[model samples]
Target chain A: MEVFIYGLARGSTLALMAVGFSFAYGVSRLPNFAHGAFYILAGFATWVFAQSLGLNYVLSIAISLVLLAAIGAAMYRFILIRVRGMEVSEIIASYALGVAILEALRCKFVGTGFSTPVFIEGTIKVAGVPIDLQRVVIIAGGVVVIGLIWAFTHYTRLGLSLRGIAQDERAALMLGIDSDRAATIALAIGSALAALAAVIILPVGSITVNEGYDVLISALAVCIIGGLGSWTGTILAAFILGFAGTLTATYIGTMWESVVVVAAIILVLLLKPSGLFGRQKEFEERV
Target chain B: MDILEVKDLMVFYENAIAINNVSIKCETGKVTGIFGSNSAGKSTLMYAISGIMMDMKRKEEMKGGERITVVGEMRLNGEDIMDIKPNDRARKGVVLCPERRRIFPESSVLENLKIGGYLASRSQAQETLKYVFTLFPALKDMKGKEGGFLSGGEQQMLAIGRALMAQPKLLLLDEPLLGLSPAMETRLAQAIKKINEQIGITILVAEQYARPILPVIDYGYVLENGGKVLEGTAQELIDNPDVKEAYFGV
Candidate 1:
């Protein structure tokens, strides 16, 4: 029960962290290295709004989400747009911006003191396993986010336009979707997702500059394992990694947990190069 | 009046000319066909008119390789659109059903149509979806199939149907019958005629083979080596011995 319940919590946390990065990359083919920056920045911004300004907690989160989305759109329009197709440059540019933001935050706040209040303050027993209410919320939030994303992509015009661009830019453009516009919208939504993940997950452990990097790594790991663009593959990967981590800690020492992740990635790469559900066509094209 | 007019158009990839000093006029509510063999610049002309040349130019600049230069005056509905983005051109009612049927491969047939309707209002989209279904009923049956899974003829139908969902004033078809059976070509040719007649949407189609389309086109141009060599009414082209020998295999 402990392994199952705790693993579920861990998996949800990962899903929240990674979905935004996967979404932006999948849609625009833009790997947002600043995704982690947005996550940490949201935590800090929400903290400033909620604690320093004495604003309502929910309102603070809402404001931060909007701000992060705008920042994301601006990032694409002003900076990343220029380096759109050049993959290597995109990574370097975004990663540099991410470092700048995170390092700036570290310089200013330098905190072990930054954290947010949980929305609900309690504990619940799931299958005879005691879990905090925030962890439970993260799990529920993960399910809800995935559901909303599925519906959005499947049913909505704007969402479908983004997916269309992801599949074929020329075809999408021929259909009257502004490829850049679709990319901008994708970046905005991705940033907001990062912010959402941060607000919900950061309360458990204090937000720090390093957590930003850690979040990005976790997101990257999950996305890679899940097969970069496969929606089902991401969730399944999250659970797989989640259970893998839990089992590692339970059987071997907690020290082996990190090794398991890297090893699994290497193993998957060696075996299925495109990740489990990854479309192999992209690889074939490159070859 | 001409819905689209290209004057003194020239395109270059560093030095080799793709299109040279080609001028063409497409009348409102008429099908104008441009026929050419491979690399004779039929696709390039379509790309130039649709503003995809500008798109490729930008992409090349970003890549810092293979500079593409397009110097041309393209007037759509009497407004100069020589340097506008492809999507903006699409919004302004010149939508291209690109060569090789570049439909979204991973997307379902229905989703492909829906994406094409991105610019349409909800009611317009609904009406156009019905129209597209009626025009290509084969598409209606395989609404849930991925576009890549469709046969070549079915894929061409989906591509045309998808473009129709955009509700363009001037539709551009670039080699719409590139890889299809003769029967399929004739069927698609009839459908193209119906689209022009029933909806009154102006069409500018580029083709390699003129037979399947000759019956449907009002005016046609023959292109060779990226330059316009001859053009006239379909009957006049049929009467010309050179065109008959070269194109009709007489």
Candidate 2:
């Protein structure tokens, strides 16, 4: 039961990260592999601000979110838009973003160990399980993040435009979407979400420059398992992955955990190519 | 006074003149039709006026990349709108319901309409929605449906509804009846008339089939091979022997 709570906490973070990635792909139609850079870089940034700079945890998180949002917007305007007309095989743009961020981080702080200030420095007992308060906070933050994202996509004008772009960008443009503007907005939000996840997860685990690749893989798995372009699917997949990982680690063995996940995902894919909750050409076909 | 005026406008595609020295005026609260054969620059002129086509003639001269040479002037409400951006033009009350009925395929019908009302205030957008729903009640029934699933005719109605949501002073419609059945075409035609007569929306339509459009337009221009072959009132073009021989196939 305690293990399940731990897994849920971790899965919430993964779900938030997946939502960010899904938004960009949903609206921009570009699978930005570089989004992992946001996770890794924000982790590094939070560590630096919290440990080296002696900034408070709250301040570091705020600065990280704002900085990442700005970086996302700049990357979209200066780079992504330029490579937009290029073929999808041009994953080079994302690679370029990753290289730039990694290089910049390395230059600023070389050979620094990863550490982040605790989000909450206490423990709580729930359902006969003792849980870290920070983990609970992380989980709560994930819930808030997902809720806000859902609302943003459903309720706001810019959100509607983003949804419109996700549907068909050229059509949105003819309807006057200002697509470049929409892209910038989406990138900013996506980056902010990634940064938030990074900060939330940092205190729970040590973050390293290379750890970004791992998070990237996890986010991709979550996104694919949930299905692309669907927010609700991403969240559900996150919890499923979380509990599954927990159950596997607790019952089976640690060695075969990742293997089990891979096999499970394959089985799910075979059964439903669009993911568990994804609609495969069935959403708008009725009309 | 003319709401939209295109004078000596020439659109080209790699040295081929799609629209050459074509000049026309769209009066307020009037329906004008540009009639032509398939390759006769009807869609080209509409594309030019809507700022969709690139003026390939002036590519090297301008600061922007691949300058589209627009030789003459396009004006709206006596203001030169040739230099303004397409979105800016739309905000300025000159909207186009393009030929393909470019509805955002994944968006709900209501969302599509709201996007068309991009320039309007929140309340104004709702009002526009009410107006469009009133004009095309079929769309109101499918408000939550994605546009891609709509039938060709329903999508055309949505396209026109979207343009009207912009509350344009001048609506430029390119082939609204394309691919639609005769009954659907008549339905759209009636909506176009209602927009003109009831709401007094000034409209310019470019169509290959003149029979459905001819009776409704106050004035018409006939284009052949990228140039205007004839221009007159709807009745004059209907009665003319040249028009009868070429267009009506009498």
**lDDT by residue for model 2 (A104-204), tens:** 77666555456786866888899999988888988898888878877877677778778877775545555556667887888888888888888887777
For candidate 2, list the clashing residue pairs, or say none.
Answer: B55-B68, B55-B69, B58-B69, B59-B67
Which regions of candidate 1 are displaced past 4 Å? Answer: A280-287
TM-scores, all models, native as reference: 0.97, 0.86
Q: Which residue pairs does candidate 1 place in steric collision?
A: none
lDDT value for model 1: 0.91
- Fnat, model 1, is 0.78
Question: How well does candidate 2 match the true structure in TM-score terms?
Answer: 0.86
Question: What's the count of clashing pairs in each model shown?
Answer: 0, 4
lDDT of 1 at A201: 94
Task: Note the DockQ of each predicted structure.
Answer: 0.60, 0.26
The prediction achieving the highest lDDT against the true structure is: 1
For residues B157-208, could you state the per-residue lDDT of candidate 2 as single tens digits? 8989888877788888999988778898888888888889988889999988
Real contacts recovered, all predictions? 0.78, 0.21
